[model samples]
Target: MAPLEPTQPDCVWRNVAGAGKAECKIWQFPTRVSRCTDATNVTGFTWALTQTWQPPEGQVYKLNFDAAIFANLLASVVGVIIRNDRGQVMAALSLKGGVVQDSDEAEVVACWKALEFAIDAGFSDLIVEGDNATVMKSIASGQTDLSRLGNIYDDIHCLARGLRYMEFNSICRSANGVAHSLARYAKHLDEDIVWLEDSPPPALEALLAVSRLRLNEELEFTEL
Candidate 1:
C-alpha cells in the first residue's frame, strides 16, 4: 500500500484460463491507485477459462449495486456484470461498497461480487441479476441459508462449478440500471478500478451519481 502515484492499477485483474493456457497478470497492487483505506476489507479475485467455446446455458449474470451511495453523503458502490453467449460484456465489476454495513453486507457483497465477475469472464452459462431481491433469493435458493451468509453463498456456488453452463436469476430493479450506474461511479475511487472493454468511461459524464428515491433509486460519488 505504498506505491501508486502514477496511473494506478497495481491491485487487481487476474484472469487465468487453464488447460489450453491463457493468463493475464497484475495481481499485486502496482499498476496504480492505492492510498489504502487503512487496510482491512480485502478480497479480490477474477477468473475465466476456455478450451474452445464455453458459457452458454442461459448465461447472464448482472447483479447491480448502489445503495444510493450515502443518498446525500455518497459511498455505496458495488456493481457486477457478466453477460455471455456472444451477447458480449462477459465481465465487469466496480466496487466501493460503503453505505455502512451495506444493508447487511449487501447480498453478501453482491454474491462475492458475482464471483469476481465469474472468475474473470470465463462465462460458461450464467444468469444472475440484482437490484437486490434478497440477493436474488440468496442466489436462487441453493441454500446459502444465512448461518452468517454461508461463505458468501458458498463462494457463489463454487463459482457455478467452474462454469460451463450456470443459471441464477431474479432481475427487476428496472433491469439493473447499467450496473446501477457503475456502482455510483465506484465512489470516486480510492484504488482506481476500471475494466471496460466497451463503454462507459468518460468519467461517467462527470459522475452523474443518480438518484430519485422515495423508495428506490440510487447512485453516488459527486466531486466530479
Candidate 2:
C-alpha cells in the first residue's frame, strides 16, 4: 500500500487492491480558472446584454421606440426609429413628452408618440418594437384597457387604425439601443427633433452598431 500521487498537474489518482482485484480512480481540477478583481472587470466579461435588431420582411417597416424618464425634470423623453427591410433608416424622432409618474406610463406615452410620429411621417406598414414588455403586450392585446393609462392606449389604438399594417413586438433593451440612445439624448434638447431617412448624432453610433451586427449575421448565414 503506497500513498496516492498526482499523475498530472491538475489530477490525482487513487488505487485500491484486495484479493487480486484492483481499482483506480482519478479526480481532475478545472483546466482553466477566472477571477473578477472588481465589479467593472466582472461586467467586462459578461455575455452580451442585448440582441441585435432584426429587419422587417417584405415592405414592412420596423420601428423601435423607447422612453427615458427624468423625474427630477418632471418630464420624459420618447425615442422612435423606423427602418425598412434593408435596415435603412426611414425616420427617427426624439420627442420631449409630458411628465409621467413611472416607467410604465412613460413607456405607454412613448409608444403613443412613436405611432403618432410614424403616421405623421406617412409610414403605413409598421412593426413597432419596444423593450417594455407590459406596454407592448397591452398594445398588442387589442383589448380596451381600463387601467390608468387607458386613454393613452386608446390614442395608440386609434393611431394604429390609420396604418395599413401594424404590429407590436417586445424586445430586449439591447436590441432597442438606437431608440434608447435617442431617448437619453432628448434630455439635452429644448424641443422635439425629427430625422427623416437619417438618425441624429447621438443615435448614429448605435444605429451603425446594429447595422454592423446585422451585416455580420447575414455574412455568417450566407457562409453557412
| Strongest candidate by TM-score | 2
Please give the lDDT score at residue 29 for candidate 2. Answer: 22
Sliding window of 10 residues with minimal summed lDDT for model 2 = 12-21
Question: How far is 56's C-alpha from truth in model 1 (Å)?
Answer: 14
Task: Tell me the tens digit of each residue's lDDT in model 1 across 72-151.
Answer: 64445676655444434545667775444556466566556656666565545444544444554555455546566678
Off by over 4 Å in 1: 1-80, 83-100, 112-150, 153-155, 165-224
Model 2 TM-score, 2 decimals: 0.75
TM-score of each: 0.29, 0.75
Q: Candidate 2: global Cα-lDDT? A: 0.71
**lDDT (10s digit) by residue, model 2, range 1-224:** 33332221111111112111111122222123211122223111111223468788898898999998875677999888999998888999888888889999999999988888898899887778887756766675566889999999888877776677666655557789999999999988899999998657888899789888888988999999
